[model samples]
Target: MRIAATLRMALRALRRNKMRSMLTALGIIIGVGAVIAMVGIGNGAKSQVEAQIASLGQNVVLVFAGNWSSGGVRSGWGGAGTMTVDDALAISREVPGVINVSPEVRDRQQIQANGLNWNTQILGEGPDYLDIREWPLQDGAMFTDQDVRGTTKVCIVGKTIVTQLFPNEGPVGKSLRIRDIPFKVLGVLSPKGLSVMGSDQDDVVIIPYTSEMKRVSKRTNLSSISVQSSSPEFSDIVQRGISDLLRQRHRLGANRDDDFTIRGQQEIADAATATTRIMTVLLGAIASVSLIVGGIGIMNIMLVSVTERTREIGIRMAVGAHGRDILLQFLIEAITLSSLGGVIGIVLGVGSAKLLSAIAGWPTLVSVTSVVLAFLFSAAVGVFFGFYPARKASNLDPIDALRYE
Candidate 1:
């Protein structure tokens, strides 16, 4: 009976000051909403990054040139000119963990097809490039070993290049000119979206590495090499094997540093995941401050409520209501108010996240954990901040409260 009466009275009091109650709840609503939205966006970004990394395959390794010095001055951009075709072949022959190797030489050039032209990145690699990079052909066949050996004028175009250069016609068997050198299109690549670095992976043209080195780049050195290990679990073994092979081939005396760098997919994934996690935590912490401020707002309003209802408290005490009953009544009112705000905030937060995702084309993932956490924290804030005001109302003297005008 006491619980029922306390609830009835609390409801009546809340109804009597509807505007003030709503204003108090608004703070909590905004705070909880912000927290949920921020967390959802952060998780979505992390998942997107992981998905992009996974798309590159698991057992992949990249070998690139390390910094070199000429006359004691560092030479080449990104420490270029370390790894060579001979080094790649040596690693394939000597390294037990290496399954396949493809040396790459890259350049940016204008490509023209059917009178349409666009500038795109061109990569030259052997037939194993397709196997190592896992680039599946969309329409036509990949270049063969003979094509690479003879420096044949055959090319595979990426999806973006197909769209821009050969929009109206099929690219297969079509001839495209790369810097005025005509080549037969052998294949069109499947679409791969923009990478984390904002580069369009599908906006490229690929030809045999030997052809690019001799005819396009006119350079003997390679830019990098792609290596695939036999097993994903043995990435470290593969890396070490390649490093040792390169060291021996380069003939660096003991104590001299290596002239090449070997990187695996796992290392890139770990660094990216760690960075994303830190960003998510930081965003969550910043949003949580809003909840704290909302709690303070609830406390302030509860104090005002206690001051306004002092006479009512005195009457209840006179009529045989215990101090505990008064405390419970006010506490319940505060909890109900904050809890309702939390629910509304959750709805708003989810809607806002969906809207942003649709409009911006960004991914948004809402987890059950985030929702539960938001609700519980909002309710706890009510209890923590409501305690003082509830206690003050309960401890009031009946005589003094009654005498107050």
Candidate 2:
């Protein structure tokens, strides 16, 4: 009953200065809201990046052709033609846990079909390329292994190619010219949107690597190789096997550096998401400063309230109220202000996140964990900041407080 009465008195005192109480709580409200919104934005971006990484397919490993340096000059991955189709064949034949392999030859070319020409990426890939990428055909079927072996003039078109060159008609069973040589369109690939690098994924054509090497571009070396492991658990083993096999095939000694670069799906994902993770921490830290400021504001207001209510404290003490009771009353008031602000802040933060998503078209994810943490932190700030003022009010001499003008 005493605790209930003390809480009621605390609430009544707050009601007497509604504007001041609200102003004091405004800092906490903004702080919690900012933390929630910023974290949501960061998490959303991280999720998007992970989704993009996942689009590369599960248990996927990538081998880029070049990473050699000589005479103070360095060649980045895919910059040198150190990898060959024979190396790719060796990996497929010899590497354990390897389920699929595709030697890649990448280029950009202008192609014509139905009196329309569109410049698009020309990707020379193996028969298992679609399987390795987990990509599906929207129409017809992928070219067979026989097509790759025979260097057949057959290809699969991406969505952009279909839209640009085969508008008003299906592209399957149609012919498009690459470098004035006619190639049959065997399939239309399902849309894949943009890649992690923000490049349009569905803006290319895929053909047999042999056909690209023998007929067009005349490149003797493979650009890169895509490998898929039997399962995610076997990805690391597959990568190690591939690295060793490639090193042996290229005749690199123990002392010599690797000429090729190897990366697994998980590695790629971690690297891609690292920036967003840092950004999340940075944004949260910056927003937390406001909460501290709000705490200070609460402390200042409580101190002033204690001074203004000194005479009330003396009267209550003379009437048999204990020092602990006076302390509880002020502490409860501070906690009520902070807890109320926290609730409102949560609402404001969620609404703002949704509004930003709708208006700015940026993704936002407000997780339950962030909301709970913000509220708990706000309440903690109240206790931390409100203690000193309440303690001082309780410690004041009753006679002196009563004599104060």
TM-scores for the candidates: 0.84, 0.93
Which candidate comes out best when scored by TM-score?
2
Model 1, position 294: C-alpha lDDT score: 85
- Model 2, position 98, has a per-residue lDDT of 95
Q: Using alpha carbons, what is the TM-score of model 2?
A: 0.93
Candidate 2: count of backbone clashes, pairs at least 3 residues apart or interchain: 0
Q: Which residue pairs come into collision in candidate 2?
A: none
Could you give candidate 2's per-residue lDDT for residues 1-405 as a string of tens digits?
277887788889999999998998898999889989999999999999999999998789999987777898987777667899999999999999999999999998999999999898999999999999999999999988899999999999999999999889998998999999899999999999989889999999999999999988998999899999999999989989989998888889999988888999999999999999999999889989998898899999999999999999999888877888888888988988887778888888889989999999989999999999999999999889999999999998999989877
Question: In model 1, where do residues sit more than 4 Å from their true spots?
Answer: 1-13, 77-80, 90-100, 115-117, 230-233, 269-283, 311-328, 360-363, 394-405
Q: Write the per-residue lDDT of candidate 1 for residues 165-276, one digit (tens) a residue.
A: 9988999999999889998999998897877666899999999999898888888888888889999877889899888888887887899887887889988878777877
